[model samples]
Target: MERELSRTLPHEPIRWLKEAGFGRVRLPREKGGDGASLPQLFELLAELAEADSNLPQALRAHFAFVEDRLNAPDGPERDRWFERFLDGELVGSGWTEIGGVKLGQVNTRVTPQADGWSLNGEKFYSTGSLFADWIDVYAERSDSGGPVIALVNVAQPGVERDDDWDGFGQRTTGSAPRVLLMRGSSRRTSMTLPSASATKLRSISMCCWRRWRGSAARCCETSARA
Candidate 1:
C-alpha cells in the first residue's frame, strides 16, 4: 500500500484506500475491520511513511476514524453515525490550532447542553479535513481539568471551512483553517490514548539504512565488534 501510495498519492491514494481495506484495519470487526494491534499498525505506519509521508496520514485518518466510533457508546447512535468511517467513507485529523496554538493550548471550548454538547472554536492544519466526514476536536476547560475531545460533524450546518494549505511540498494534503459553530448536538468526552513519539529517529534510521552501504555498514559493524 505504501509503495502504491507513494507513487500515486496527491492524486489516487484515497480510491486505493477505500478499495484495499487499509481504512478499516483499526475499526471493530463488526464495523468491518481486522482489529489489528497497535504495534502492528505502528510498524505499518513506519513503513508507509518511508514510502510516503502521506500514506501514514491516511493510516492515521483510518485510526482516528475507528477510534472515535469505538470510543462512542455502542447503540443505534454509534452504529448509525460512525459506520461510514469504518467503511473508509471519511478521512482527516483533529490536531493543530489556529495562530500557533500548541498542544495543551487549546482555545476551543465545549459547553454542556441538554441533549449532548456544543463546541465553538477555530482549528487549523487539520490534514485531509476537506475529505473528512467528521473531525476529532480538543477543547480546553476554562474552569480546570484535562482537555476534552469532541466528535464534530463537519458536514452539519454551522461548520465553516477555510482551506488555505498552500505548502511548497506536500501540496496535496489540503490542510487549512476551520471554524466550527456550536449549534449541533455533539458528544463531548475525553479520549484515552497515548501520545505519539518523535518521528525524527525513525526518519533518520530509515533514511540511513534504506540505501545500500558499500563501506559504511562494514565500518560500523567492525567498530561495534572492536
Candidate 2:
C-alpha cells in the first residue's frame, strides 16, 4: 500500500475496504451491513488513518452518504440505496467551487430538459471523486433558482474528473477537479446534495484540526487489496 501511494492513489486498499463491507458500518445488519455504532466507526477510521490518513479522507463522502440515507424516509427509494451500499458502491462529493466565486454563490446549475435534466458546471476540491461510483452534486434549478441535491453516476459520459489536487499533504486523496457537462439529456434529478456549504464549515475545520494532530480520523475507507 505504501509503495502504491508513492505512484498514485491507494486504489488497492480502497477496494479492500469495500469488499470487506467497511462502508456499510453505520448501517443495520438486517439491511445487509455491518451494523457498527458511530463510535466504533470512528475508532476504525482512526486506525485506518494511522496506516494511511489519506484513505479516510477519500471516503468521507461515502460515509456521509450512508448517514444521510439512514435518516431518509423508509421506502423503495431508500431500500434500493441500502442495497447499493451493501454492494460496495461509493459516493463522492461535489459541493464546492474555487476562485472568487464568493461565499454564498454556486456556479453549478441544473436545468430541466425534454428527457430529464441538464447539469453543467465545474467543482474544485472534489475529494474522493477519482474513485467514486457516484457524485453527490449541489446545484440550482435553472427554472426556479431553488437549491437541490443531485446524485450523478460517475460513469456517465457527461462527467469528467482531473487528477489535479496537489494540496500540501492530502495530495493522494482521490480528489480532483470535476466537470459535469451533460452532453446529452441526463436523468431526472442527477447527483444532488445540499447547498448547505456554510453549515459544514465548522465541522470540516474541526476534522482538519484533528487530522493535523494525528488523531480523530472521522470518515471513509478504501478499495485495494494488500
Model 1 lDDT, residue 165, Cα: 51
- Residue-wise C-alpha lDDT for candidate 2, range 1-226, written one tens digit per residue: 5543574788888999989988888889898787897668777887887788788889887777777777666898789889888888898888787667988798788888887878877887777888888888777887888887778888877787877655655767877654333344576345443535533643564465466445332222222221
Per-residue lDDT, model 2, residue 125, is 79
Best candidate per lDDT, number? 2
Model 2: how far residue 29 lies from native, Å? 1.3
Q: Against the hidden true structure, what lDDT does model 2 obtain?
A: 0.73
Each prediction's Cα lDDT score? 0.56, 0.73
lDDT of 1 by residue, 1-226 (tens): 4444343334466666666766666666766677876556666656655556665554454465455456555788667645665556665666566776554577777666666566667776676766566676756543454566566667766677665554444544546445333344454332332223212332343343333232444655898999
Model 1 lDDT, residue 103, Cα: 49
| Candidate 1 off by > 4 Å | 1-12, 28-31, 39-52, 64-82, 100-103, 141-146, 177-226
TM-score of each: 0.59, 0.82
Could you tell me how far off, in angstroms, the CA of residue 114 lies in candidate 1 after the best superposition? 3.2
Top candidate on TM-score is 2
